[model samples]
Target: MSNAKSYIQTVALRDVKCYAFHGYYPEEQLTGIYFLVDVEVTFVHTGDTENLNHTVNYEVLNTILLEEMANSQKMLETVVRRILDRVLDTYSFLQTGKVGIRKLSPAMPGEVGHSFVELSYVAPK
Candidate 1:
Protein backbone atom coordinates (compact mmCIF):
# COMPACT_ATOMS: atom_id res chain seq x y z
CA MET A 1 0.00 0.00 0.00
CA SER A 2 1.02 3.57 -0.54
CA ASN A 3 2.19 5.66 2.42
CA ALA A 4 -0.40 8.35 1.74
CA LYS A 5 -3.26 5.94 2.37
CA SER A 6 -2.21 4.93 5.85
CA TYR A 7 -3.68 6.38 9.06
CA ILE A 8 -1.35 6.66 12.04
CA GLN A 9 -1.60 6.70 15.84
CA THR A 10 1.18 7.06 18.41
CA VAL A 11 1.77 6.09 22.03
CA ALA A 12 4.84 6.75 24.12
CA LEU A 13 6.16 5.93 27.58
CA ARG A 14 9.19 7.76 28.92
CA ASP A 15 11.85 6.68 31.39
CA VAL A 16 10.57 3.34 32.63
CA LYS A 17 12.95 0.87 34.29
CA CYS A 18 12.77 -2.85 34.84
CA TYR A 19 15.46 -5.18 36.08
CA ALA A 20 16.38 -7.94 33.69
CA PHE A 21 19.11 -9.66 31.66
CA HIS A 22 19.38 -7.28 28.66
CA GLY A 23 23.04 -6.95 27.86
CA TYR A 24 26.04 -8.89 26.62
CA TYR A 25 28.13 -8.09 29.70
CA PRO A 26 27.69 -10.08 32.90
CA GLU A 27 27.17 -6.97 35.01
CA GLU A 28 24.28 -5.90 32.83
CA GLN A 29 22.15 -8.83 33.91
CA LEU A 30 22.90 -8.11 37.54
CA THR A 31 21.91 -4.49 37.18
CA GLY A 32 19.56 -3.29 34.48
CA ILE A 33 18.97 0.29 33.36
CA TYR A 34 15.91 2.31 32.48
CA PHE A 35 14.30 1.75 29.12
CA LEU A 36 12.08 4.05 27.05
CA VAL A 37 9.52 2.99 24.47
CA ASP A 38 7.53 4.83 21.84
CA VAL A 39 5.05 3.20 19.49
CA GLU A 40 3.21 4.41 16.39
CA VAL A 41 0.42 2.51 14.70
CA THR A 42 -1.11 2.99 11.30
CA PHE A 43 -4.38 1.64 10.00
CA VAL A 44 -7.08 2.22 7.42
CA HIS A 45 -10.12 3.88 8.82
CA THR A 46 -13.63 3.32 7.48
CA GLY A 47 -14.53 6.78 8.81
CA ASP A 48 -17.54 5.64 10.69
CA THR A 49 -18.14 7.43 13.98
CA GLU A 50 -19.78 4.42 15.63
CA ASN A 51 -16.95 2.01 14.81
CA LEU A 52 -14.83 2.35 17.88
CA ASN A 53 -14.26 -1.37 17.59
CA HIS A 54 -12.26 -0.83 14.42
CA THR A 55 -9.81 1.53 16.13
CA VAL A 56 -6.83 0.70 18.31
CA ASN A 57 -7.24 1.12 22.03
CA TYR A 58 -4.46 3.16 23.60
CA GLU A 59 -4.99 1.51 26.99
CA VAL A 60 -4.45 -1.95 25.58
CA LEU A 61 -1.32 -0.78 23.84
CA ASN A 62 -0.01 0.71 27.08
CA THR A 63 -0.67 -2.53 28.95
CA ILE A 64 1.17 -4.54 26.33
CA LEU A 65 4.18 -2.23 26.51
CA LEU A 66 4.19 -2.45 30.30
CA GLU A 67 4.03 -6.24 30.19
CA GLU A 68 6.84 -6.43 27.62
CA MET A 69 9.01 -4.05 29.62
CA ALA A 70 8.52 -6.10 32.79
CA ASN A 71 9.71 -9.18 30.96
CA SER A 72 13.36 -8.61 30.18
CA GLN A 73 15.21 -10.03 27.23
CA LYS A 74 18.79 -10.00 25.96
CA MET A 75 18.28 -7.26 23.36
CA LEU A 76 16.22 -4.14 22.97
CA GLU A 77 15.55 -5.10 19.36
CA THR A 78 13.98 -8.34 20.47
CA VAL A 79 11.88 -6.50 23.01
CA VAL A 80 10.72 -4.01 20.42
CA ARG A 81 9.82 -6.75 17.97
CA ARG A 82 7.95 -8.67 20.63
CA ILE A 83 5.95 -5.64 21.63
CA LEU A 84 5.03 -4.93 18.03
CA ASP A 85 4.07 -8.52 17.40
CA ARG A 86 2.00 -8.64 20.57
CA VAL A 87 0.06 -5.56 19.52
CA LEU A 88 -0.52 -6.83 15.99
CA ASP A 89 -1.62 -10.22 17.18
CA THR A 90 -4.03 -8.81 19.73
CA TYR A 91 -5.42 -5.94 17.70
CA SER A 92 -6.30 -6.43 14.09
CA PHE A 93 -6.96 -2.75 13.51
CA LEU A 94 -3.26 -1.89 13.28
CA GLN A 95 -2.08 -2.12 9.68
CA THR A 96 1.47 -1.12 10.59
CA GLY A 97 3.56 0.00 13.56
CA LYS A 98 6.88 1.57 14.47
CA VAL A 99 8.52 0.68 17.76
CA GLY A 100 11.44 2.44 19.45
CA ILE A 101 13.21 1.11 22.52
CA ARG A 102 15.96 2.99 24.32
CA LYS A 103 18.40 1.60 26.85
CA LEU A 104 19.54 4.32 29.22
CA SER A 105 23.09 4.21 30.65
CA PRO A 106 24.31 1.34 28.53
CA ALA A 107 27.13 -0.97 29.48
CA MET A 108 29.65 1.39 27.92
CA PRO A 109 31.55 3.16 30.69
CA GLY A 110 31.63 6.66 29.27
CA GLU A 111 28.35 6.59 27.39
CA VAL A 112 26.73 9.81 28.54
CA GLY A 113 23.56 9.61 26.47
CA HIS A 114 21.04 6.84 25.96
CA SER A 115 21.46 3.95 23.52
CA PHE A 116 18.47 2.71 21.54
CA VAL A 117 17.10 0.46 18.78
CA GLU A 118 13.99 0.98 16.68
CA LEU A 119 11.99 -1.22 14.31
CA SER A 120 8.98 -0.80 12.04
CA TYR A 121 6.51 -3.44 10.78
CA VAL A 122 3.53 -3.53 8.44
CA ALA A 123 0.70 -6.02 8.77
CA PRO A 124 -0.01 -8.24 5.80
CA LYS A 125 -3.21 -7.56 3.96
Candidate 2:
Protein backbone atom coordinates (compact mmCIF):
# COMPACT_ATOMS: atom_id res chain seq x y z
CA MET A 1 0.00 0.00 0.00
CA SER A 2 1.18 3.48 -0.79
CA ASN A 3 1.79 5.62 2.26
CA ALA A 4 1.56 8.98 0.49
CA LYS A 5 -1.50 11.00 -0.41
CA SER A 6 -2.51 14.51 -1.42
CA TYR A 7 -5.86 16.33 -1.33
CA ILE A 8 -7.35 19.82 -1.18
CA GLN A 9 -10.50 20.44 0.83
CA THR A 10 -12.45 23.47 2.00
CA VAL A 11 -14.69 23.55 5.07
CA ALA A 12 -16.95 26.56 5.23
CA LEU A 13 -19.70 28.02 7.38
CA ARG A 14 -22.22 30.06 5.42
CA ASP A 15 -24.38 32.84 6.74
CA VAL A 16 -24.02 31.88 10.36
CA LYS A 17 -26.08 34.71 11.77
CA CYS A 18 -25.68 35.68 15.39
CA TYR A 19 -26.69 38.51 17.65
CA ALA A 20 -23.71 40.42 18.96
CA PHE A 21 -22.95 43.71 20.65
CA HIS A 22 -19.95 44.96 18.76
CA GLY A 23 -19.70 48.63 17.93
CA TYR A 24 -18.56 52.05 19.12
CA TYR A 25 -22.04 53.16 20.11
CA PRO A 26 -23.91 52.30 23.29
CA GLU A 27 -27.10 51.53 21.40
CA GLU A 28 -25.25 48.85 19.50
CA GLN A 29 -24.95 46.71 22.61
CA LEU A 30 -28.39 47.51 23.98
CA THR A 31 -30.14 46.67 20.74
CA GLY A 32 -27.71 44.03 19.50
CA ILE A 33 -27.40 43.11 15.78
CA TYR A 34 -26.80 40.36 13.24
CA PHE A 35 -23.53 39.10 11.87
CA LEU A 36 -22.36 36.26 9.62
CA VAL A 37 -19.28 34.05 9.52
CA ASP A 38 -17.62 32.00 6.79
CA VAL A 39 -14.63 29.79 7.45
CA GLU A 40 -12.56 27.76 4.99
CA VAL A 41 -9.80 25.32 5.87
CA THR A 42 -7.37 23.69 3.49
CA PHE A 43 -5.08 20.79 4.21
CA VAL A 44 -3.13 17.98 2.63
CA HIS A 45 -3.99 14.37 3.23
CA THR A 46 -1.33 12.27 4.89
CA GLY A 47 -3.14 9.05 5.62
CA ASP A 48 -4.16 6.14 3.45
CA THR A 49 -7.85 6.21 4.30
CA GLU A 50 -10.51 8.94 4.34
CA ASN A 51 -11.42 9.24 7.98
CA LEU A 52 -11.96 11.92 10.58
CA ASN A 53 -8.51 11.34 12.01
CA HIS A 54 -6.89 11.77 8.60
CA THR A 55 -8.32 15.25 7.95
CA VAL A 56 -9.73 18.39 9.52
CA ASN A 57 -12.98 17.91 11.39
CA TYR A 58 -15.86 20.22 10.45
CA GLU A 59 -17.88 19.43 13.59
CA VAL A 60 -15.13 20.72 15.79
CA LEU A 61 -14.88 23.84 13.66
CA ASN A 62 -18.61 24.48 13.96
CA THR A 63 -18.49 23.97 17.70
CA ILE A 64 -15.66 26.45 17.99
CA LEU A 65 -17.61 29.09 16.09
CA LEU A 66 -20.72 28.46 18.18
CA GLU A 67 -18.78 28.90 21.37
CA GLU A 68 -17.13 32.07 20.13
CA MET A 69 -20.45 33.50 19.03
CA ALA A 70 -21.79 33.10 22.54
CA ASN A 71 -18.86 35.04 23.87
CA SER A 72 -19.61 38.44 22.39
CA GLN A 73 -17.00 41.19 22.10
CA LYS A 74 -16.61 44.77 20.85
CA MET A 75 -14.83 44.02 17.59
CA LEU A 76 -15.29 41.45 14.82
CA GLU A 77 -11.62 41.81 13.98
CA THR A 78 -10.69 40.62 17.43
CA VAL A 79 -13.27 37.86 17.22
CA VAL A 80 -12.03 36.66 13.84
CA ARG A 81 -8.45 36.70 15.07
CA ARG A 82 -9.40 34.74 18.11
CA ILE A 83 -11.25 32.24 15.98
CA LEU A 84 -8.28 31.79 13.65
CA ASP A 85 -5.95 31.42 16.61
CA ARG A 86 -8.20 28.84 18.18
CA VAL A 87 -8.47 26.89 14.94
CA LEU A 88 -4.71 26.87 14.49
CA ASP A 89 -4.21 25.79 18.07
CA THR A 90 -6.86 23.09 18.04
CA TYR A 91 -6.48 21.46 14.63
CA SER A 92 -3.19 19.97 13.57
CA PHE A 93 -4.35 18.76 10.15
CA LEU A 94 -4.89 22.11 8.44
CA GLN A 95 -2.18 23.50 6.18
CA THR A 96 -3.98 26.79 5.63
CA GLY A 97 -7.27 28.50 6.33
CA LYS A 98 -9.22 31.74 5.86
CA VAL A 99 -12.08 33.28 7.77
CA GLY A 100 -14.59 35.85 6.52
CA ILE A 101 -16.82 37.76 8.90
CA ARG A 102 -19.70 39.93 7.79
CA LYS A 103 -21.73 42.51 9.62
CA LEU A 104 -25.22 42.38 8.14
CA SER A 105 -26.53 45.38 10.00
CA PRO A 106 -23.72 47.82 10.48
CA ALA A 107 -23.98 50.82 12.77
CA MET A 108 -23.51 53.24 9.90
CA PRO A 109 -26.12 55.59 8.50
CA GLY A 110 -29.03 54.76 6.19
CA GLU A 111 -28.84 52.71 2.94
CA VAL A 112 -25.51 51.19 3.86
CA GLY A 113 -25.17 47.53 2.93
CA HIS A 114 -23.33 44.77 4.73
CA SER A 115 -19.68 45.18 5.66
CA PHE A 116 -17.14 42.39 6.03
CA VAL A 117 -13.58 41.45 7.01
CA GLU A 118 -11.38 38.44 6.27
CA LEU A 119 -8.16 36.94 7.62
CA SER A 120 -6.01 34.09 6.37
CA TYR A 121 -3.44 31.85 8.05
CA VAL A 122 -1.10 29.07 7.00
CA ALA A 123 0.45 26.46 9.23
CA PRO A 124 4.21 26.28 9.36
CA LYS A 125 5.61 23.47 7.25
Per-model TM-score on C-alpha atoms: 0.77, 0.85
Count of steric clashes across candidates, in order: 0, 0
- lDDT tens per residue, model 1, 1-125: 56554445543444455545577676776787777778778776755546658677777888888888777677788888998899889876666787887777766679557887989887776
- Give the poorly placed runs of model 2, Cα more than 4 Å off: 1-5, 47-49
By TM-score, who's the top model here?
Answer: 2
Please list all clashing residue pairs in model 2, or write none if there are none: none
Worst 10 residues of 1 by lDDT: 6-15
**Native-to-model Cα distance after best TM-score fit, residue 31 in candidate 2, in Å:** 1.4
Give the alpha-carbon lDDT of every model.
0.73, 0.78
Clashing pairs in 1: none
- Model 2 residue 5 CA deviation in Å: 4.8
Per-residue lDDT over 1-119 for candidate 2, one digit per residue giving the tens place of the 0 to 100 score: 99655677766777788777776567776787888888888877565456777766778888887788677677778878888888988876688888778888676789667888889
> Which parts of model 1 have CA positions greater than 4 angstroms off?
1-21, 49-51
